[model samples]
Target: MVMKTKLLLIAIILFSTSSFISNRPVTVFMIGDSTMANRSIQNKNNKERGWGMMLAGCLTDRVIVDNHAASGRSTKSFINEKRWERVLDRIQPGDYVFIQFGHNDEKEDPKLHTEPGTTFDDNLRKFVAETRSKGGIPVLFNSMVRRKFYCNENGLYTDSLIDTHGDYLLSPKRIAEEKGVVFIDMNKITHDLVKQMGPEKSKELFMWVGKRKDDTHLNIKGARIVASLAIEEVGKKIPALGKEIRRYDYVVATDGSGEFFTLEEALEMIPLKGKCTVLVRSGQYGPKPPFVNKKIKITEEKGVSWGSSAAHAEKPLKNLDLYLCVGQSNMAGRGKLSPEVMDTLRNVYLLNAEDKFEPAVNPLNRYSTIGKGLGWQQLGPAYGFAKEMATKKHPIGLIVNARGGSSIRSWVKNARQSGGYYNEAVRRTKEAMKYGTLKAIIWHQGEADCHHSEAYREKITQLMTDLRNDLGIPDLPVVVGQIAQWNWTRKPHIPEGTKPFNDMIKEIPAFLPHSACVSSEGLTPLKDETDPHFDAASQIILGRRYAKEVKKLIKK
Candidate 1:
């Protein structure tokens, strides 16, 4: 069967944050007869394998395939042997159970015999209800074809395929229809496949070679094909689980030293609405590239020589400009949001708490991994700045990693340490860069560092150098905004070194390359002069000013 799926692969340095993009891992429990059991072959002469043996290879790492099927066990015997109870004991919420058991149920032996309309149907319903009771999703798959074909008068194998499972297959179908469970008709799918291959050629799928006369069990090659077929159906029936299925179509070398160089070039080869998976090899890959077709889903493959994470999106993202918004409270925005400022800006997205891009709205800094609580999250300048810069053709992505009441020393010192604000900011920015190009850095801090304003210029310069070097942008444009000019007459508690700090911020453009400073000369405070934070109106103006500086820098 032709499967339609979209997949992308990109190289990324391994980190704990890589797992944050996806939800918790889910287990897929496979329960059935020997046809689905895991077989042991001491010698290569036996050469018998089950389709379930290849299941895990068909899915992503998030899915764990636990095959519980046994040789010579039917639905009745499985429950009687407490095998079903064992499966039940391990079934957790959000797990999936694949139930397929009709092979041994067709036997006349009382130990496994079950009438299709009565005991078999009852057993199927019981499995579904009990799985749901444990909060596990239950999917029923009817028994596979037994390789029985009809022959014509000429002695050549006919195209007609016979059904050996008979009414037993109808039991799972009926139970699935009645209980509202997902059902995959493996009988019909295998029947069509076998019929198309004809009698002679189809033997390669089963164990019809020397010493192995088994027609029910599949060989290694056959197991892989069946596993792929089942996974394809799962993707179509269960979208959430299906999207996690892993497959590769291309290989990439990030260093531009291999056959395929960059991700953008690989993405350009995929046809529109077509599906492909690219395997990214190890190398140092920067973020200046844009995907030519669709937004890719990034999944991290660990333990390999080259570590990587993948990202995916349905819509096409082109020329996505990314900016790192950092510093203290002003950059995080203490402004009260108005209705207009709260509205989501068109073509602007935020690298949210989950590291996925969502529409840019108020409290853009709420997604900061190192930032404070949601109460501190409010209207930030990024909303207005993105609004001023974003267009229908060119989208924008913002990484607002700032904290309130933070000192310049804290930022500079933390730049070299792990789990600190500076490193957290860099990590988040790099994650966001996987989807877009880094445009500039916006800094509006220094309030808490007023006590050390005498050397503010020197410290801020060091901070800029560290940020640019670590981010792989040696001459990246840096835009600093002057701290709020507290009304001293009404707010006498304002820091004595506030004027000096502002002077140092204003002097950034003099010596720093590709850098500028935005003026906060007339911006309004949050509530009154006593409030050090900017008001909603002033935050909007600050955003516009920052965008103006960015536009001028981009021109050069």
Candidate 2:
């Protein structure tokens, strides 16, 4: 019984030790030439960077990237200088060694140059054998492409990207196949990337900073892109290493180059309560697709920007026109959302409370952060106006932020005395601008402030001025819809200040540079013309009229 107890304790200790060893992080040792070397940010002018420098950012914390590549070092020089020896000494069980060398091997220098079939192939086999002997997995990578644009018969630079690596690219692949190790074709990968970018745009990928233009070396942007390409392959060829790679929620490219071709496909990947960012390439897309209850932020890649900045690129999508719809309850739409109006417009989008773009439907203002909740929301003018302005080619985005009974003074910039919501409106609008261009501001409030015309003109003028200044649009178009001209709860008496408020709206374009007003004349109110809100039919007409006024202002 004593011997059995001792044996059981020994077994438990061995199992715990194995578990700790397995859970430890895996190290990835990168050995290559200058193209894969870590470079110093010498000055503002120095732009040369290596692909290995950006590799760690693409991976999770479980992978430790130890890059030992140096500038102007070949397979021959690396082994001779004991750099490979240093890396080999650190190789533990279950680690990875990424080998890439060819750029400097093709050089004519005595110390750097190695014949592709003989010395180059031999050095690669040596690295693979030594890495495996240490129980470390070896993955080989061919050198990246040099951005050399070949000239056509017309003597003009064509879009074709010519390869300059020659036979040096084959040595690594041949050794990988013989040694039964995973090989990543980084040369062909970057070649395809530069080719797709074309001749002129490809210059942004190489070391073409300031007055220096070296196609053989990579800049910061180019290096990150190359690293991503390598890892994309690593995720496929090396499954264990691939599991340690970071995953993105969405990747959209108009050219069908990213993970998902369309925005809808990417959005569908989001699970409930999932925090996601959509990485989009610069291009014109169709209408913004509708998503339900998911918070998604979109980022546009202005160019081939990779690494962390690539995930948060700020350039907005082209051809998507944004219109800010702000005011009181009338603009918020109290009318019933009919079955016909309930469906989403083809090319119209609603900026939701989470600052995401979805298909514009009835109760478009339901997502307003400062406005009343869904209990007070219904059909409004935004739907009809977006429907009128949108086309198959031109997408219209609506930002509806309005309180049911908000006074004009409540919208004054930093109006602390009135507990104003001007700051919230500006914050939402600025956030919405990341998705599209801000074309116009639609206003339809003033029922609350109708009783007094005291400094009303100056207040409204200051509001527009502050909004335009804050938005950085000196001549931003403003479309004001006249307040409802009906009695409340079927009372025969109309508000005395209603006419005066409408009159002020008429004189807006006279003083404002790009402002216009739509009349509320002949528009029927809800429930036997008793309610202050316009009925569904009248709301649609009001939206159409607002669209007409907006068109005229936009033309100017």
Candidate 3:
């Protein structure tokens, strides 16, 4: 009996030891660039933190978060600089390593870059292999979308900017699938969330405070939300970690009423109780409707009648300033609208001063405060631009005065003072005054000037100067779209002088002040010798480039 009792005691001790070993804390190591790096003040000892810092706070004690991300490092640089090696040396069996990159890799600079075609993918594979070799689980996350969201006539979220570095996400996803590694699409997740939030309130989830107009990085609140999203994604993809997650409950609120509320109203209604989502129904709200008052999502839906309002927890309302969008044809758009897009534009109201027109007349014509225009089309620049800005939680008012085939010469101040294009643009600018304060002017009209390249530079410069003076906004930002590759002439008959004309147009932004150029050189749609209009993919690229330039201009 004594021997049997001793054996039972030993068995119990061994079982307890095994259980403890199995339940040991799971270490999570984060590796990436400034977007995921620990925020430390290089200028001063500021307490700003990165998304990785907030990640651990969202999980249970069973998970340990250790971020080793640095500023301005691509996948190749991270490895070449031995950053990944340092991370791997500390990793233990059963640990997890989360890799997020692609922001810096997209840089064309040779010194600090990774070519998305080969280097980016190769680096990702190496990270995965090294992690697995050390008995650690390699988890990959696609780069997050910068906080730039625009909507089309149908009011859907356009994927212009998101698609630019698409290979950034695709490479990781492909490797994960091939190697059986865990892949979390932070990009797609963020995109869906932004669409749900609409443009206005989504801005609150980004780094939108003083001196930094960085859409690539997240603020404290933005970091927290991103961390929470990452946690939720991990729980869904990795079953073993599901029970360990503490914040996975997302409450979505949809507005069934066909009429949409301002972003302000939606922000007021979204509760701070838990992870919440607010979907506004498809319909026009007022101009500069408070779309992004906070970190809440404002989405739109069609075909299905959603609920009116959802209440989770009451919170004080936050006020947000409005953003105005102005430009020409590309700004107007040429794509077909989807239900999702229309639903997302619920809060974006067009101040159409012109008479009622077809929703298709100009899907990009969103400036008139009282007139109707083409209401449904795939958005070009505005959809993506507005959606991205709204995601930053800033109030947005788009004052569009773009005319198809319009030239820069037409937009001069005094219609009677100048002939040709100047007179028409000045007249339209006068008509656009009733809409609101013209914050920015987006110009996409260099095609006509290509035919008259000899004097394009001087004419464009004068027009820009006159425009700023006339609007009384000498510092107003003027964003230009570089003419993409187009075949304006008939098949087998290329315009001999078009190339030089286009090349000269590309150099306009270099000479102008307060002006930035969005390159559409590589974004033209594949076509025969006839159709020159950009395709959906190319439009997205153009829009994203515009957003990037705009963000830089707006940065303090």
How do all models score by TM-score? 0.44, 0.43, 0.40
Write model 3 residue lDDT over 326-393, tens digit each, in one string.
33445555443333344334233333444211111124454433212322123567666655554334
Q: Is candidate 1 or 3 superior in lDDT?
A: 1
Q: Backbone clashes per model, in order?
A: 10, 0, 61
* Cα RMSD (angstroms) for every candidate in the order listed: 19.3, 23.2, 22.3
Residue 534 displacement (Å), model 1: 51
- Candidate 2 lDDT over 494-554, as tens digits, reads 4453776678878888877789989999988754443567877888999999999999988
Local accuracy of candidate 1 as per-residue lDDT tens digits, 1-556: 1121111001111111133243656667888987787765334344566787667657765665667888899999999998898578556567789999999999999999999999999999989999988767888999999888887898776788877888998988788767667789999888888888888888998988786677788876677677778888866776767777766544444222122455666566655566556555433233535554444543323311221223223443434799999988878877754334545567787787667676665678867776754435667787678889999777888999898767777788564433388887788888888778899999988777764666787888888899899999998999999887764324356545367667777888997889999999898876566556787788889999999999999889
Weakest lDDT window of 10 consecutive positions for candidate 1 = 4-13
Which order, best to worst by TM-score? 1, 2, 3
Q: What does the lDDT read for residue 152 in candidate 3?
A: 72
Q: Candidate 1 vs. truth: CA RMSD?
A: 19.3
True-structure lDDT of candidate 2? 0.74
Candidate 1 stretches with Cα past 4 Å from truth are 1-22, 44-46, 248-301, 304-556
Q: Global CA lDDT of candidate 1, please? A: 0.73
